[model samples]
Target: MEEMPLKTAEELEAECLRLLHANMTTREIQRVGIVRTHADGSGPNWTYNQLYPEPTPIGKHDAHGIIASVAGKWALVA
Candidate 1:
């Protein structure tokens, strides 16, 4: 019979965390019941989604802007 190699400490830690997360996801699913398993697009999220912020447009004056007159009229004079 052939013996398999043992995992290193780092590998063990990573594997343990992976298993824990899998178990938690499974438990959450079961607790929520089968009918509502996928109710949320996201599975019981532990983190909020602000990693990538919503794109904000820069003011035209800061970009490829035009000049405005004292009369509150804008023209392509810039």
Candidate 2:
């Protein structure tokens, strides 16, 4: 099988922003947060925060899918 192309940082950011805008409310966006494992498959690596206008947290499964999709690795999943 052919390998999939990785998304650029800008493209990933844009897609994330689009998802937030489409699925989250203004309040939810402000409170949005993402957490992921480190590259070494250890525990959580870091956390990020920003001022926006939302209040809901993204679910783990959804977060995994989003990350995979943006990274262009979705097709590798069964």
Candidate 3:
């Protein structure tokens, strides 16, 4: 098998953005906010409280910045 050509930074960024949006929109992965439950079977377990589009501490906005940086248009991202 022949090796494929390396993708330019712009191509890579576009593909990354496409995949990110596709996955989120399709709900293939769920965004979750964890909560600690107790040992009484009701207070020490993890919970999914935050849904999509919520302001997560480390969210997709960060990935947008990375994409912009790769495309050499970080100003547009910010």
Which 10 residues in a row give candidate 2 its minimum summed lDDT?
Answer: 40-49
State which candidate has the highest lDDT.
2
Best by TM-score: 2
TM-score of 2: 0.38
**Candidate 3, 4-55: lDDT as tens digits:** 2334334443444554455443223233332323222211122223334543
Q: At residue 47, give the lDDT of candidate 3.
A: 27
Give the winner by TM-score: 1 or 2.
2
Mind giving the per-residue lDDT tens digits that candidate 1 earns over 1-78?
Answer: 232233332343333333323542221111110111222222221111111122124422221111111111211111
Task: Please give the TM-score that candidate 3 achieves against the real structure.
Answer: 0.29
Off by over 4 Å in 1: 25-78
Error of 3 at 64 (Å): 14
Error of 2 at 62 (Å): 5.1
Clashing pairs for model 3 are: 37-43, 37-44, 37-45, 38-43, 38-44
- Better-scoring candidate (lDDT), 1 or 2: 2
Task: Write one digit per residue (lDDT tens) for candidate 2, span 1-78.
Answer: 554443333444555556655543421342334333334222223233342442435543354344444444312111
What are the C-alpha RMSDs, in order, of all predicted structures?
A: 26.3, 7.7, 17.1
Task: Please list the C-alpha lDDT of all candidates, in the order they appear.
Answer: 0.23, 0.39, 0.36
